[model samples]
Target: MSKSSIYLPAGFRFAGVTCGIKASGKPDVSLIVSDRPLVAAGVYTTNQIVAAPVVLCRSRTPSSTVRAVVTNSGNANACTGSQGDADAKAMCAHVASLVGCDETDVLVMSTGVIGKLLPMEKVKSGIEHAVAELADREEAFFAAAEAIRTTDKDRKTESRELELGGESIRIAAMAKGAGMIAPNMATMLSVICTDASIEPKEANAMLRRVARVSYNRVSVDGHTSTNDTLLLLASGTGTPLQGDSLCLFEQELTELAIQLAKQLVEDGEGATHVMQIRVTGATNDASAETIAKTVAASPLVKTAITGGDPNWGRMVSAAGYAGEPIEPAKVSLRVCEELIYENGTPLKFDAASLSATMKEHPQVNLDLCVGGGNGEAVYWSSDLTTDYVRFNSEYTT
Candidate 1:
């Protein structure tokens, strides 16, 4: 499959290599390096059993000072006790030495099956080869994206063009996570790179706000992973940027991030359809979001939607358990204006017609009403299927 790419910043480059880590012949380790220190920011999974690289990267990135990113696939490097930590540090140190950068300047990420050990000897040689080929930046991006995928069907990518200070600024992003999703609705890894000048503090703040509004809003099977990381680095190569440009850049970043986030859920293992759950009409936007997530996460609701049953009761029941103060008697539900429920009672509507529509479009709207809070949220997700269970049950085998 031909993949479209994001426009990377000037100083960044990437490369990938087969480290004999995975049984497959494909590349399993990758590298991304910046010629100079870049403003880097990261957001990680809330999962308690976080991977070794995630733990290490979190320690390095919050300083907002980063120069390189070392990544590996086919081994998540989690639950390996002290050995995992040592392996992660060794990987970073090897990559740092190859790239002639400080160990503190390198950020590490690992993905794939959990409770696995990385082949350090193979990984070290791959890093050496990748460093030797750092002359091509564009290839680096593609390699980086390819190196992190687990069960993804295709590479997910997005980019945006922006004008800042009479200069053209480009923000590009890529991600992968077709399963083990559901970190408040997302379990994915993404990287965004830009040629705009911004402070590390500013960039870190922007990424946090964007992640909350975008990636956190999506869900897929409600299964979060131990190694979910989203990292963004600013090159400052184009122009000295701040103010509205920064906000605009962040908005574009969020959009691109969301695109990849939703793509992950849509292509999730055994997912045949993509659904958008939009919730509106609550005491506040936060309440509306809470209500929407409840419905989206319900196994019963998702299964009903998969079968095109349009079960309104399941939707309302989810909202009822959303950990928010919501009154069923004052709430309403709708499936694309069908008015499935009103005032806590089922609204007589054309279930057959709505179900047919569900088989056509990729959108799903589930409006919940509690009061005049008028909150709204959009969550991208997929319905559960028998194939989904089978795929996950035998994934590592």
Candidate 2:
């Protein structure tokens, strides 16, 4: 797709601007506004110590329509007690006032360092500037993507278009996350907009289903953030999808979400390679997911991948502790097409060739088959490196 092809659905405008929040002086605030009330659905982090913004947005769930979303980076506005909640509400109210909508029609999201109060004055100025600059254009969309970044290496955005109900429908999304990205229901802040009309109930169901397999399946550092939020807004500017058209829309949403999820892993903090873990022949999908996630979150497995060491033992150990019943005698393992373990024994393989393959490929595939029950799942993750350690060690300083 061309650079200009990533357009937002009709009736939506975007803006991103710098507040004095980040020491780097980069854009730290973003705004997304619809020309009219748009149906909105969202999934948020399951973390117990939720951010103020997450709490606020969750309260607005099942809302028939929302007019705007205001987001900020460089300050998570989490764990600040009542003050954080006040700040979050202030953000929504500010955006609502600018957009001529009720505060309840505005959703708020925050990312970056946690346990700090928001710089309200700077945020106020930034929101004013962003609202003034809002426009329905690629540049504005790119700015919105850039403004949500914390440790991310670059802006992540995806777009899809298809003919549905004799109308050209478009879906576009932008996400920002590179660390603290494991999510129970969502990932680090993402906003998706589509022109196809869909009711709030259907949108909610579709968002949850798509998120389960996409954002919820990936892990960066195995630490879910307090501000993980994913919102889908429908402008209702095109024909409403029904029957097969709705199915097609769901498939396209899944594809776009998966694309964005992989982008987050590829840009994982200090990550050198992306590892895809697949578990098949399990008792059920839940079991498969547990095993895949276990292997994906294992530091030993991640570090081994970082060093190009095809250590199969770590993979087996991870699966064993995943709390799923496994027939050790029937288990099989492979890394990028090389079957190194099967029939209860580790097969002899050329370590040099495997290491060379790891060195040459930025993506490493690990598949584990435990007996034959037809259940399967896939999870994406990044290799843990010393650079990851170093970057995080000095992240707050």
Candidate 3:
């Protein structure tokens, strides 16, 4: 299928450039421009050391619209104090001047290592070149996608079609991630462009719901990034999906976003298996997520999964430590349809056979039952690997 065929409700253009800020000389800057102003909404990382661009982006939304988005990979421009904020603003000012829009109408994002200053000069020149180079072509989208990479080995994107307000709405999204991906919003960076005609309120609501299920459910190292960002912009180009018609649009958006999010998780530093953890029969939905994340984030458990060991005790104990009050005696755990533990006790299953099952597929499911309730949560994650440690140990060098 064509890359742009995902979901685009309006007209938009993208550009990317290589600025030497990152250690690698590949592309390190990108531009996302709407043909016109777009109603936009964003979600940022909970990290205290928020990036300079993130702060500025939040301030300019709601009251004002956005016309251009400037982003960079390599230096997060976080924890750099006032100077960082100025650099972020300068990036926006440069883009706004090129696009002939208000500075408030321009947004900026950054990713990669933290506690670093943005090479403003390189970014400034890059933005000038990117603006003059913008083109409404597929090659531009692919190149822009590449320009935002940090450690990612490949570019990731997804799209879907839905009928809203008696018209068809197309939703297309792209993301870059490879490490520091334990989500309070992962160290991930993304800019989703849509052609759906959505108001700011509707767009905000949709973004909230999507983040909870997509970005919120993915983790790699249980560490949030200082520069995490996920922004959605509707250019009002495609069919206008509103009210109940929005239900289908929301579903499609969440699904595509989740698909992209999962792809990033699976591609984590040195991930080999994509594990899906489902916690059911919890006291409430919140409790279910607590349990799921606890089990999913356990390095010991993740390593065991990667080694193809059906260590049921590790899974059960991880849930036990999720901080949610649960009756241990009533807990149950399963891996890929094989009941490994029941009533908090080991089941009569062949360990070698189960280990074989775990190694046979790239996907593994951990089903946990807290008993007596229907609350549940499904999360996407990856197994820990020694290679993962080696990759990050010298990432800065």
Candidate 4:
């Protein structure tokens, strides 16, 4: 698709620039500003040891409106103690001064190496340059997406336009993530904007629900980052959405989030295949998700898929230990359309054929039925490869 297809919602401007935080000297800073106060809500990483920016953002999230977001990639402002906290506040303060808003009206996010301090001199210069270059255009949005990347192979962006209350409304989003991914949020940063008018209470509720099924259902290496943040902003520049229109907007938002989440898995560090794990027949949705996550996060299962080996036993074993009761005789499993296990017994199937099928497709489907219950859930994960090990081993260098 054309890059311009990822258009920003009305009244938003974006800029991205290099701040010398990355050794490669790629763009490492991004600023997003709204023309007016917008309803905002955010979901952050649940990690106990949060980054400085996470702490700052969490403190201001109680407010109903926000005007700007400042983010940087490389040199995560984490574990610097009081200094890190001060630096995070300074970043917001700088943005607020330039945008003519209170410090609380701006949010900050940073990602990259942990336990390092931010280069305040470079950051100040980068923020000033970014603010000066801000513009409402596709190129600006693309730059903002690119500046938020640390190890991502590609920039992730999505947009949708729909008519609400006889007026056109647009929703656009951009995200950065490749590794350190798991449930309870991932090692990622994302910003979503819409021109539809929405109240703060309703917007927050909608974002939480959307995240549970999208960002919360993806796993790369079963690791949650300290800097994960997902923010949603509503500019109120379009006709107000109510009742069915609000529901429609939420549905579209969920779809867009899912699209970006899937992209993260597809672009996972050294990932060759994306696995869609669907668990059904459980006693409840929670049980189903627990089983699916167990299978999706198993290293053995991930490695088997990476090598195009149709080793269904590993998957079955992972599901059994998901802390949920399951009858061996009632369990059934399938990889794509080929049945590998039934009635708790391994079925005779052509291993070569299944392996070939896996090699031919970038996506692999694993369906498991544990019981006759009505609960069902789905999760996405990436196969583990040798390169994933090598890259992370020397990431500090």
* Candidate 3 segments exceeding 4 Å error: 2-9, 237-240
The local lDDT score (0 to 100) that residue 184 gets in candidate 3 is 76
Residue 244 lDDT (model 2): 96
Q: List, residue by residue over 163-205, the lDDT tens digit for candidate 4.
A: 8778888888999999999979966999998888988778888
For model 1, what is the error of residue 30's alpha carbon versus the real structure, in angstroms, after optimal superposition? 1.7
Residues 91-165 of candidate 1 have per-residue lDDT tens digits of: 889877877778888988888888878888888887888787665466667877787777888877777777767
Tens digit of lDDT per residue, candidate 3, span 314-341? Answer: 8888888888878788899889889878
Error of 4 at 37 (Å): 0.3
TM-score: model 3 vs. ground truth: 0.96
What's the lDDT for candidate 2? 0.91
What TM-scores do the predictions have? Answer: 0.94, 0.98, 0.96, 0.98
- Compute the lDDT of residue 289 as modeled in candidate 4: 92
Scored against the true structure, residue 201 in model 2 reaches a CA lDDT of 90
